[model samples]
Target: MCVAHASGAPPSASTKAKSRPCPESPTPSSLRPMTRPAPPRSGSWTARPPCAAVLRSSATTQCKNLGPCTSGCAQGAKSSTDITYWPVALRAGVELRTRCRVREITVNADGMADGVWYYDEDGEEHHQRAEVVVLACNGVGTPRILLNSTSPEFPDSLANSSGLVGKNLMFHPVGFVQGLFEDRLDSHMGPQGCCMLSNEFYETDPERDFVRGYMMQIVRGGVWPWSTAMLGARSGTIPWGPGHHEAFARRFDHTANIGILCEDLPEEHNTVTLDPELVDSDGIPAPKITYTLSENSRAMLEHGVARAKEAMLAAGAIEVTGGGPARQAGWHLLGTARMGDDPETSVVNSWGRSHDVKNLFIVDGSIFVTSGGVNPTSTIQALALYIADTMKKNLANLFD
Candidate 1:
């Protein structure tokens, strides 16, 4: 319950570092606090320095605007782990390695994780021996590593005695409700996805067709103009060819959007497996994600869309588009290496330590037993901080 941030991590470096007073203290809770999305950076052609540059403002390193920051934030405005924890770790003398792709974790003779085989950016192989192994490779990447770490002692892959390493994959299926309005809403002004949200339908209703519900988040305009125009026309949201300009003009400023982040139950069939046909440049097998929505999820989506359309209409939308079952929407991948009490049914235990390997700990969304309708980053970071504290309590005998 320590995750009380608007997002997963604290915003300002001073607050995170504790030199300055934190607005709130950690509290015990099961649910995470919800907040509006990032500030709108739409229609922006300007760039700012990342936090690192500010740290050394009088010195070298200036931020360059690579693009829209849709792929990644070159300006370092993003509170990514590299900028946050990595810098602190380096200052503490922790050796930080960049661009190294891990192949698999190597186990010792007694089936204990002790080392890793990874390839550097130059394709040079390196074996890193460690007292503990923490798998923080999101759901998909972690499972791929485990599945590929096939050894004679643990033939089914390391720490995969449960045969559930890559199973029970859960993704928060998403569907958008776009509303075209009469007046300009300036929907694209702020960072695209960061707007007010509603949790009115966040809980499950037994009376309904699904066991769980979803969150309806306000999605303002942050998409590129061309994407909005072309895809809108292609998807029939706008007119085509000559008339498309007129349609785009009408919808551009006068649009309201909402995204539904649905809770997905863990299904063993939704899996991540190494593709025999696909491999990375280092010749390591790449993971192939195979997921499909269950009937319950589909029913939930139908209900959600209906509710969204109703809301759009109430908000005076001239036209509403985008609904039904979400396709190609796998935003929050989770439950692949789920945590549980039993070693036979789960890959990791309650604290995200591997059931088959005592030294291996998973501190990511992969340990999520359930995918909440809300954003998981805050919860994920909270869990990590909790686990780190737990490990600290046992640092004297960590390898045991």
Candidate 2:
């Protein structure tokens, strides 16, 4: 893995190390049961849930899986960015810097992206000039950097003439629906990221309380023994003390899970602002993310949870336990610097070019117009590639 750009929001670093073992293929054998398509609904009988390819790895394998791919594909089989584009870019001689944090985007009197100022590991500041700047520091980091780059001429923020740089931040609200089985499904035996998904209710129905919908995926919800035992106790399913051992023994291998990825709308109030009082070690202002689920999201969650329970029951699970919207995990942050035709309403144009700085481009989830219910990485990558192609054609005009 080689990291070229590092975010300034938190204690972060880049790496240029090689990964061990190949990521288990997306169709790992252990994941078949999880990957099998959910049946179509026959009303009362209920259909097999639709499958979502949101797995950190493609497939699920039992003990063969070192752990869930999210933890660190110990088996070396996760389709991560490091193993993908980095190799090609490196082979082509793109310098890969580790532990370099971009302090701010520098602009010239021409009001174009001139380059970036950054800090080395020793806290030494350095400036790197560039003909153009492409911001991909993620939803929070991108906006945080842009907001911090307030020059005398652009007091509001660079690339933020509409005052929308850090606004409309979004995260796909998630809820877990766990099912307890009488027999040991050995749920802990496979990849933890979800394998199967149901999209019966994916589309928006005017009759439903929400507008956009959500997705449900089958998850291992399995952690290593310690985490599993601890989470069991925390959820109050397993008792503490002498009974803890026995309770843990029974529950460890007998669980199945369904997880919800609710569609979150772009809301101005859900924003990423720079903290007035906090700063990172590099002396850059830290990010202050403010988010709240709307009524529509809550209602969508309610519907998803209900459907999750029904799915579990149909699968022959003895009991189901779960709830709405995961708060700790903000895996997908998007829409802060949206791409649209209207400069008055967006930060970047449709091709991700800044309306204020034509040479500056953004090609990340931050350019998303809407938050889809599934993992956004595939879409994020697709957009990045598209932007690269567009940049190839417009490179001559990029800095003009």
lDDT of each: 0.71, 0.73
- Per-residue lDDT, model 2, residue 35, is 34
Best by lDDT: 2
How far residue 245's Cα lies from its native spot in candidate 2, in Å, is 2.0
Worst 10 residues of 2 by lDDT: 1-10
Off by over 4 Å in 1: 5-78
Q: What TM-score would each prediction reach against the true structure?
A: 0.80, 0.83
Candidate with maximal TM-score: 2
The C-alpha local distance difference test score for the whole of candidate 2 amounts to 0.73
For candidate 2, give the lDDT of residue 218: 72
